[model samples]
Target: MSCGYLLQMDERPTLDDIRRAPKVLLHDHLDGGLRPATIVDLARENGYEGLPTTDPDSLGAWFAEMSNSGSLERYLETFSHTVGVMQTTEALTRVAYECAEDLAKDGVVYAEVRYAPELHTAEGLSLDQVVEAVLEGFAQGGRDFGIRVGALVTAMRHQARSMEIAELAVRYRDAGVVGFDIAGAEAGYPPTRHLDAFEYLQRENAHFTIHAGEGFGLPSIWQAIQWCGADRLGHGVRIIDDIEAGDPPVLGRLAAYVRDKRIPLEMCPTSNIQTGAAKSIAEHPIGLLRDLGFRVTVNTDNRLMSGTSLSEEFAKLVEAFGYGWDELQWFTVNAMKSAFVSFPERLELINGVIKPGFAQLKWRGARPVA
Candidate 1:
């Protein structure tokens, strides 16, 4: 299991080095990580031609550009094309299967992909049908690739169907749906708008995460956790704003509570920069938060938009924050600990998958670093 080149001396670290480092992904989006070639083919097959470029590479770049315009609403527009082609069961299954294969290849042992079922029902599939197709794809992919996958059925913040989506997620809990989430614009559509759904989820003993502190600020995060009962905070990057850099920055009440409670922060470094949530990757507060004992996990919010994979995200963190195998392993464990999967299953992943992977990755030979 020892790759002689596991540690590239003096190069920082690289995707290759980290690719063998077991990781867990908690915040990836299904419609946000479609293969460029698949999108092109899907679009062509469905006779829907609205893409800026037909070529796979060019279309990939187009999605990235469209998502980088500094406006959350504008960034979400890119998904119109992705979700458009994902309406059919076959397309959804293919995307889900490919998503698992990609994560497996990138060294992720566990992943939970989230998407709003309401958005994919445009082609007449029921919520149950969409969930079934996605689970089928994930199950097949996991069986084929050895990557454990889970689904999060999200309710769009702008919609009034949170209760329905929460029910769908709870209903499929036994069938591989791990949790529920609220996505879309966070500024106007606060988690309070989905209180009923959150309440129902809590009563049903279902786990849920919330999209907060990404587009909005501390108020949004506070409401999501304090009010709506979110288990984790998606891109809770703005919690830093509530912090005061007395000499080296002080965590406010909310930040301190999040840290003390061990609420996981699903931080996507490149995606935060792309969405203007963080000015730069080096300036991201994840390092500080992690240093302060906040459960911080790296993620690819949208691979296509951020032009990043799980390995790439880890490589960037190493380059920017001097993270080594220990820190990388810590992040992986943090993710697994914070995942919505059951306690026994999560522990199994850590002991059986992550620990062994890192044991092999901490090599001293010639692996290339950043």
Candidate 2:
């Protein structure tokens, strides 16, 4: 009996294609992607209390259920549980280290994991201590797992601590912090609310990616780019609204600017559908945006919440859009090119790690027949 999977059986890629592919991740949320078993272990160690279930399987289902409600408020509630357990230095270190290990296992060669330091301060640890512990964890994880990891310090959009988080990111830039970000609901709180922090990052010559256009629309993306000077966009999927589709598409001012300027959009297909940003993975606008020359990269916004990984996200795209090795390679290169790392560093990652991986895949077997 046929399982009726989306891709043609003959057209499906080999395991070698999946295992050997190079990947880059830019839009993951550290608080929303914890392994269920790790959460249980951490909770037990900390005695911080309150889990819906202690059993790992039950807890896993609880997270998927809670996050699937499609209300941003309900979705965000799940993070409270993860963040609550990650209060102490030891807990923080363990979670960060496990995050690296998980990503490495899923074939993510490079990643920029993000979390809000303000969330960890509830246990009375200073923001600086939180940064230091997480950095140490990622450093150790990288050495142990052979994956390159960096942290993106996040500021909650609904809160008034962007300036403080901005300072914290700058303070830890040399230690493993690579960039800054603003996340959370975009409907009521606008990007301009945190203009001072963005301005501060600018003066310090720091980089940032804004969470815009996922649940909201084009204006949020416009302000994040034009007003706040974001280096990249998180879930800028809704920018499709500004472009009229045709044989040759026509772009509005904002869409045209985004494409012409080659701004990188971190598009997470499954999370976009779960969060009600897009209707379906098959209908996502990434292909259109990519065809139009905008720099688009695939990502798993919240791996646990979305039940996905970088490899899974790529597999879904291959099924939905018939993307083969070449397309996947281009997207990975796009992510590396758009990463917040310094020029020479980004070049080295692409040339030294990413391109070589893809080159090996090309020589491994016969190319999949179209």
Candidate 1 overall Cα lDDT vs. reference? 0.90
Query: What is the lDDT of every predicted structure here?
Result: 0.90, 0.88
Candidate 1: regions farther than 4 A off: 1-11, 364-370
Error (Å) of candidate 2 at residue 106 is: 1.4
Instruction: Show the colliding residue pairs in model 2.
Output: none
| Backbone clashes in model 2 | 0
Q: For model 2, where is the 10-residue window of minimal lDDT?
A: 1-10
State model 2's lDDT: 0.88
lDDT of 1 by residue, 1-370 (tens): 4333345545555678788777899999999999999999999998877888889999998888887887777888889899989988999999999999999999888999999999998879999999999999999999999998999999999999999999999999999999999999887888999899999999999999999999999999999999998999999999898788766778889998999999999999988887789988789999888888899999999998778899999988898898888899999899999998889999898998889878776754345433
Q: Write the residue-wise lDDT of candidate 2 on 179-294 in tens digits.
A: 99999989999999999999999999999999999878999999999999999999899999999978789899999999889999999998888888887888899878888889
